[model samples]
Target: MEFLAVVMLAVFTAGYLVLAGADIGVGMLLPWLGRDQDERRLVIASFAPFFLGNEVWLVSAAGIVAGAFPGLEHTLIEGLYPLVVMLLAGWVMRDMGLWLRGRVDAPRWRGWCDGAIVAGSWALALAWASVLGSLLVSAMSGGTGLNAGTVLGLPLAALFAWHGAGFARWRLPEDLAARAARVPVRYAVSGAVLVAVAVAAGSGLSWSDAAAEGSALSMTAVTTAAVLPLLMAAQGLVWWTFRGRVESPSYL
Candidate 1:
């Protein structure tokens, strides 16, 4: 039952990470990708359908963590309280930016909304990475502060940017799409390499250690090792299958 619960938690985490990463990436890239007000609206429209849905995954992941691993939750809340607060604040700002950016009439207000979106998204990403870093380090070393885990934020954010760019390329028109696709390839390559290195180095413990015992961390490591490749493959296939500009006149 614990194994099953952990597996479910991983699934929820992946869902939230991938979907929200892309959603946040769009916001992060908006200033650079969009040349004008109309272009910006198009970028926003492309992600509107999935924005709220993506966030649902996050809520689900949190619930799973709180319910299934209360000890872990307590540790995280205790160690990374400030980051948790920032993450919530970032989410609120990003959500408000999404909603109000469209409703307000002034160009200045739209700019402010755009700024909020970018800032909020980056803050959420950094906070998440830092928290995860704190969790991993604390678990392994009995340490109570940030370490290499905190540095994972950059690559993780880049990964999200890559996912967002791929999404934008698939959904947006011509020049915008091409531009989006070009930038993310670099980010994708760098993010993947850096993230892999970070995870491997930070964990310190070997695969054999994880397999030797049946503890929660061990099961998580084993499950992650087994499932991550499959998930990446699935994500690759999905991207390949959907790779191309949509012919629709409207964003769905």
Candidate 2:
């Protein structure tokens, strides 16, 4: 049960890193990828169909932690409280930007929304990197400082931008795709690396020590395992339905 819980957490974390990372990356590079308001709308359109769905993986990962590995959840939250707060704030900001961007028709309103999107995306990427860095350091060494996070955060954020560019290459039209092409890395490769990093981080953790006891662990693991397939199916449906490249602005 402990092993199953750990695996499920890793799966959801990796899934979020690979799937949502693309959109987050795109959001980070919104200004460059979109340029004009119309172009920005196009760039937003590219990943708009999938962002909300992608976010579900993050929520699921959190659920797994809180339910199956309550000790780890408490540890991570306590140790990484600031980063966690930043992550949630960035998430709310980005989602608000996406949701409100189309609600108003004025250029200024749209511009502010775009700025929110970009800033929030960058914040999310940096916060995740810092969190991962802290975890890696704590796992490998016995340190709890932000030094590793500070050192690792920028590079990981850059990787996020690169990953977004790769996604843009596939999702955007020719001109915007060309703009995204500046990154020079394939989306699949970058995404795979992101997933690998997440896996490595999870593997380094002491899950056996951190998991819930007895029935709590078993029930949470079983429930998550049962629900995962349904979540995957729903995700698959969304991806398949919107697989085609965006030709115009979406409702975002």
Q: Which candidate is the best by lDDT?
A: 2
Candidate 2: what lDDT? Answer: 0.86
Instruction: Note each model's CA RMSD in angstroms.
Output: 6.1, 1.4
Off by over 4 Å in 2: 143-147
How many pairs of residues collide in each model? 0, 0
Name the runs in model 1 displaced over 4 angstroms: 136-148, 151-155, 184-252
Q: Give model 2's clash tally.
A: 0
Model 1: lowest-lDDT 10 consecutive positions: 205-214
TM, every model: 0.72, 0.96
